[model samples]
Target: MTVSKKRTISDESRVFQEKWSHNYFFIQVKEKAICLICQESIAVMKEYNLKRHYSTKHAAKYDMIEEKLRIDKLALLMKNIQGLYLSLKTGHKDSEASIKASYIIAQKIVAKSKPFTDGEFIKECMEVSFEILCPAQKQIFSKLSLSGVTIARRIEELGTNIESTLKERISKFIFYSLALDESTDLSDTIQLAIFVRGVDSNFNITEELAALFPMKGTTKSCNIFNALKSTFNRFDIKLNNLSGVITDRAPSMIGKNEGLIALIKKEMGTCGALQLIQYHCIIHQENLCGKSVGFQTIMKDVVKIVNFVRSRALNHREFKNFRSEIDAEQGDLIYFTDVR
Candidate 1:
């Protein structure tokens, strides 16, 4: 009977040689041989294994280089690896530019009342345009993150920045007037929008959207007052600096008792030297006047014409098709909102 002998390989033979880097473009990494070009790892440091990997994978191109040309090729590969690392270091700078671009696009999207998901589609169209117009810019556009989530975050950031800047401007105001309006959105939520017109000590006048509060419940006079107070507190606005309040003829806005204007006056007290001026919104008055009996005669005819095209499904579709045939910018007549 004879005992079978098992072959054993020592750690020294497993150690990678320095020459392998120049010979087969493989480097010693944690005791394993790693290919420079493909980054594939060789388990054993045997020359035959490295040679087989190089010959089968990269030898067709790299093997053609000899002497100084081989050395230069090796140097170029090393430089490429270094370049990859350097790109990561400069990625932060590129990210700032990308963020600015994203905010500009987000502003336009918000202004146009576009859904957040449109950002992705816009990016795809922009990339295609870039590919056709300037292929060199494709890499730059690829860096932008215009996904819906990213766009939402970017818009939120822009809003916060604007709010902060507006607050800073408000703090410097010598006098300011507020214009308030309330409307229900498609979701039936009451939205209260407030605008501020302010003049600083330097007489620099600034007008901006001060607040847009959502009233989940009833939008009563007291509720409107509370919302205004919250906005004032948030912006650190002083009550005495208020010059005027502007609003439509809504009872909740201009009521004598417990109205938003009355509530503000009550807070300011009766003994103030300068009286708080109340201004009815001229635009709102004009809109109300436009619906008066005198204007109704003309508007009725306009409404009839609009309804002729919009009242029926077939009429609407045919009108749209006709408009398209004529290359009309407006697809159909706009139905009058307050027409009776």
Candidate 2:
């Protein structure tokens, strides 16, 4: 009889062999695998013995691995769904916060006539909140605050709301009157400021700034009348409800021949006319009277001193510090009035 050759297998096949110990046996402690049920070396790459071992000893473990894989897949899917939901909720909350904060900022900016792009103002608000707030509060405020575009948009929204509210109040009034004055701003643009005064069912008087129309061409009586008519039309205000009108003593406004008052009276006619009273502004009359008081010399000296203190940067700074040092109640030295 001839001797049989000894079988051999690959040494590289021994990685993690213990994890499959129920089916595979180790000839060495960490190497040389053999099938547990078949008693044959797996190193020889024998498929029959491995398949037999699977059928006999490792069937339960194979089922457990498949179940674990499915559970793991389901858990990962749920985690992803939860993350998506949280992301959407956070975005909605941030949007609401922006709108709320923008509303307040818009009102304050309009009331104070502050610039929308004032970075110093926005930074100051952020910095103060950052310093005073706790970590959670800081997180909440990170979404709130100002940007120039956001401020502009919110101002428009608030303006619409205010206009609607004023319309509601004005519509309920029994009678309403208009007061108008034209003035030149620092830019030399003539702006006509209009105000409406209304009496409600209870006779409560409500007064509000109606509009500021810029006069483009000649600001004659007819032009002023047209501007007023356009503004009333836009607001749906009836000229017949107007019970009174007030204006400054300027000749263009009160002159009998082609003045704003005369034009208004003519356009209104007799039927539309009620007790349409007209009055010159008392403050303007007093300002005119103050001119004859012989105080020109004193007023000129006061103006010169105020200009000296305010026009020079160093002098202005020193004066402010001096006032602070002395604990002055008023920070400024002069309150100039438009007496001219």
Q: Which residue runs of candidate 1 sit more than 4 Å off their true CA positions?
A: 1-93, 270-273, 296-340
Query: What tens digits encode model 1's per-residue C-alpha lDDT throughout 124-187?
Result: 9999999999998788778898888998998999999999999999999999999999989999
Looking at candidate 1, the ten consecutive residues that score lowest on lDDT are 6-15
- Candidate 2 lDDT at 198 equals 96
Backbone atom clashes (below 3 Å) for every candidate: 0, 1
> What are the lDDT figures for the candidates, one per model?
0.87, 0.73
Position 22, candidate 2: lDDT: 31
Q: Which candidate leads in TM-score?
A: 1
Residue 118 miss distance in model 1 (angstroms): 1.7
Clashing pairs in 2: 9-43
lDDT for each residue of candidate 2 in 1-340, tens digit (9 for 90 to 100): 9998764455334244333443333232234454433334554434455556566675665545455674564345445655666988998988797678778877787789999876337756776777677545566555665778878888898888888888888878888988899999888889999999999899888899988999977888888889899878867787677888989977788889899998888877865656578987887888888886667867888988898998888999999999999999988776467767
Highest lDDT: give the candidate number.
Answer: 1
Give the TM-scores of the predictions, in the order they appear. 0.61, 0.59
